[model samples]
Target chain A: MNLALRDIRHHLGRFLLTAVGLGLLLGVVLSMIGIYRGLVADALGLVRAPAAEVWVVETGTRGPFAEGSRIPGDTRESIARLAGVTETGSMTFQSLEATHRDRKLRLQVVGYEPGRLGGPPAIAEGRGLARSRFEIVADVKTGLVVGERIPLGGDVFTVVGTTRGAVSSGGDPVVWMALRDSQVLQFRLSPAPARREAARGPVAAGAPDTINAVVARVAPGASVEAVVEAAKRWKHLAAMTQDDQETILTRSVVEKARQQIGLFTTVLLTVSTVIIALIIYTMTMDKIREIATLKLIGAPDGRIVGLIVQQALALGLIGFSVGASLIASAKDFFPRRVVMLPEDAASLGLVVIVVCLVASGLGVRLALRVDPATALGG
Target chain B: MTGDNPRPLVECRGLAKHYGEGETRVDALRTVDLDLWPGEVVGLLGPSGSGKTTLLNLIGCIVEPSAGTLRLDGETVWEGKWLRPDLRRLRLEKVGFIFQFHNLLPFLDVSENVALVLDMAGAATTDAFARAHELLDYLEVGHRKAAKPSSLSGGEAQRVAIARALANRPRIILADEPTAALDGERAGIVMDLLRKVAVEQSATVVVVTHDEKILGRFDRLFHLRDGRIEDMASRPGDLTG
Candidate 1:
């Protein structure tokens, strides 16, 4: 008879309840890992969606997402004229909160020219922006469908298409609009500011044609490095290859959040180890007399140690399974994206096993110290 | 029947056990010489702090004797120091112990409690369980074989404990106050079972007890006082002061 299994079976209710409590704790640990991955994924989503080989922004800026980077809208033409640059699209980025159906919708607005390199990654519903001024392609996370009209800066734009999983680094859904409309909404002064400007003197007829950055695609078998170098010569702009932009976003944009989550994960695992040790210690204390009797009956110390270790392992594995299940079932309900990968779960399982082995040391120590003579005493 | 085989089954010479040192020193068992033959039931009587349990512990190989030459079944297990490399296996294969509390693992059923001993001795699961059932049947607890220790009456639990002690068919059976909590009738039945075990299995049985009710049931008795054997009786109730 396996004593550990028999003991657990005898106390099945309490054991299962303990496992569930541990499982909930483990679930939080797993969620932290998922959230970290989601943060990286969300941070890189808008950068990757353009599918461009190079990005041209204001001098000294990492990219449009990391900080403010504005170049003239005509920077696209300069990038397009460069050798190996197959296509270029000037795009602007800004976050806006608009009220639709009396519900406030937070969105990351991307302004790109029609039939350009910058557009929604894929159209899950409706169609892409076909008009030059008012049509919009919005991500489904914004809760907007095709044909919904929302006002932006004194003008209303109609949503002509919908996309999915296109969110900004901050987790707001994205909306694509015509470059001219975005320029008017973003750069055009409000009525008060415009009137104030008018009072000073006759102002320019329109807002300056400024865009956050220009995205350019290099031709097949072309050297993207060559185009980047050429854009750098402009003195007014800085350029980066696609790989560099992704590195900047992951390493610099979300680095602090990742570190914070990692620290929390470490602390939670430490807490789990302590909890497991205390639990195993208490369980062993409960059976100290039985252990003495076992020793008196000629049971080797190995058998007693095996009993404690087996129970600890069982507790950890059961708790891990419960936590993984809970997180997988509830991930979609979280406000932020939670991306759980198979390897992550497997790695955490291995860590839990090691933690259990280490945690059972306390119980093993107490058991080994019990004197068999105690069994013969009153 | 006690000395029919001529050779002693257990021998102890100059055996001693002590605790602490110097000013704090306490001798639990003093130098002693003894012999026990096969198929004999011996009883050890002592008051509290008489070192009866300490002697049992040394004989059972669960405690190391301070100084001694001790042999069980003609094998010298302790000579000044332990001669046996694996005392646990020696205890498992050669000696069985019954405690006052029955000490059946509460999580295990009566049969499993018995089978655990055979399992520790490296017996196959099916055979160990089969032997457990057989021993439980012999002890008249076969109907309660599936019952947990907590569910059984005191008498039934002691019977299960006896079955467990006999599981490996050990040559030496040591009982420490096995009937301390039993009524006179129940205690007599337990003594009768131990006597039967010695005669039928040809095992040397040593029982440590403070109860006088079962004194006349032993084939020989040793009265211990102040860490020494104060008296020895060759027959039931026979002693030399």
Candidate 2:
């Protein structure tokens, strides 16, 4: 008979209750990992959507995703003229909050030329931008459907399409509009500012034709590295290949968040280990007398150690299962996308098993020290 | 009548136990020479701190002897140092212990408590349970075999503890105050049961107690005071050495 199981069965209610409390703690750890993964996925979504081979931004700037970058809208034409460049599109990004249906909606507005290479990767509903001036393609997460009119910059735009998983680095859903329309909204001055500008000096002739970055696709037989080097030849423009852009975004934009989450996870696991050790130690102390009795009866030390280890393993595994299940069923309810992969759960399960083994050490040591002669005393 | 056997089941010569050193030294058991034969029920009567329990611990091979040669079931188990490399295995194979309060594991049912000893002895699971049931039946507590120790009455628990001690059919059974918690009638009944077990199994039974009410049950009694055997008494009709 497994003495550990027999003892747990005798105290089934209390054991399960303890496991549930432990499960909740483990659940927080799992969520931290999922949130970290979601942050990376969200950070990379917009960068990967356009599928550009090369990016050209203002000189000395990392890229639009890492920091502010601006270049003449005509930079698209200059990049398209490079030897290996096949297509080029100008793109702009701005984050804004707007009231729609009396509910506050936060969105990342993306500006890309409609017929170029930088539109939404795929349209999940309705159609792409047919009329550029006031048509927008919204991400499904934005809670907008086709034909819904939303006001931005004192102008209303009709939702023409919807996309999935299209979000900004900060986890806000994205919406796409025509390049010219975004330029107008981004550069247009309000009446009061325009009047003040006129009183000081003559206002600029027309809206500023500036875009955040220019993206290029290389021809199949052409070298993307060669195109990037050629683009860098322009003194006012900085160039990067798609891989370089992704690396900068992940390394510079989200590195701190990753480190913070990793630290929190380590602390939580340490706390888990300590808690389990104390609990097992207490449980062992409670049965010191019984252990002495068993020893007096000539029980092998292996049996006593096995009892403690098996119970620790059971508690850890049951707690892990409960935490995993709770997270799996509730991930969608979180404000940020909580991404859970199969390997994540498997890895955490392995860690929990090791933790339990390590935690049972204190109990095992205490049990082995008990003097069997004590049982023969009063 | 059984004294004619060629050898005693337990033999001790110049056995002694001491604690600490120098100014703080204490002797738990003074040098003693003793022999207990099979099929005999003996008692060690003493006051608190008189070392009755210490002597029992030494005889059970749990405590290290300061200066002594000890043998159980014809095998020298300890002599200043352990003669056998594994004293636990020796005890498992040759000796049994019963405690004052029964000490039945609360988590295990009465039957499992008895069967645990057989299990530790490497008996097959089915065979161990069968032997546990047989012992419980022999002890007349078979009806309470399925109940947990917590639910059983004190007398019933003690009977289960006895069944556990006898599970391996050990040659030497050392019980410390086996009936210390029992009433007059129950104490007498338990003593009779121990005597019956000793005679039928041909085992040596040694009990340590201060209860004089059951004094008549032991075939022979040793009075231990200040760690020495001060006197020995053999009841009428019992063989004396």
List the DockQ of the predictions in order.
0.73, 0.74
Residues A1-378, model 1: lDDT tens digits: 799999999899999999999999999999999999898888898999999999999999997889988788789999999999899999999888888889998889999998898888899999998878888999988888899898877789898999988899899999999888877767643367754553464223365577899999988999999999999999999999999999999999899999999999999999999999999999999998899989878899999999999999999999999999999999999989999999999999999999999999999999999998777655
Candidate 2 Cα outliers beyond 4 Å, as residue runs: A189-206, B1-5, B183-189, B236-241
Chain B TM, cand. 1 = 0.95
Best by DockQ: 2
**Among all candidates shown, the one with the greatest lDDT:** 1
The residue-level lDDT of candidate 2 at A144 comes to 97
> How badly does each model clash, as a count of residue pairs?
0, 0
Off by over 4 Å in 1: A188-205, B1-4, B239-241
What is residue B136's positional error in candidate 2, in angstroms? 1.3
TM-score of each: 0.95, 0.94
Per-residue lDDT of candidate 2, residues A1-378 (tens digit): 889999999899988988888888899899999999999899888998899999999999998898888788889999988897889999998888888888999999899999997899999999999886889999999999998999988789999999998998899999999988787667653356754553464323345677899999999999999999999999999999999999998898989999999999999999999998998998899989999998889888999999999999999999998899999999999999899989998999999999999999999999999998877655
Tens-place lDDT digits, model 1, residues B1-241: 5556877888989899999999999999999888988988999888888988888888898889999789999989998889988887898899999888888898998899999999998899999999999988888889998899999998888888888888998889999888887899988988898888888778999999877888888888988899999888877656523
Share of the reference A-B contacts seen in candidate 2: 0.69
Write down the lDDT that model 2 would get.
0.89
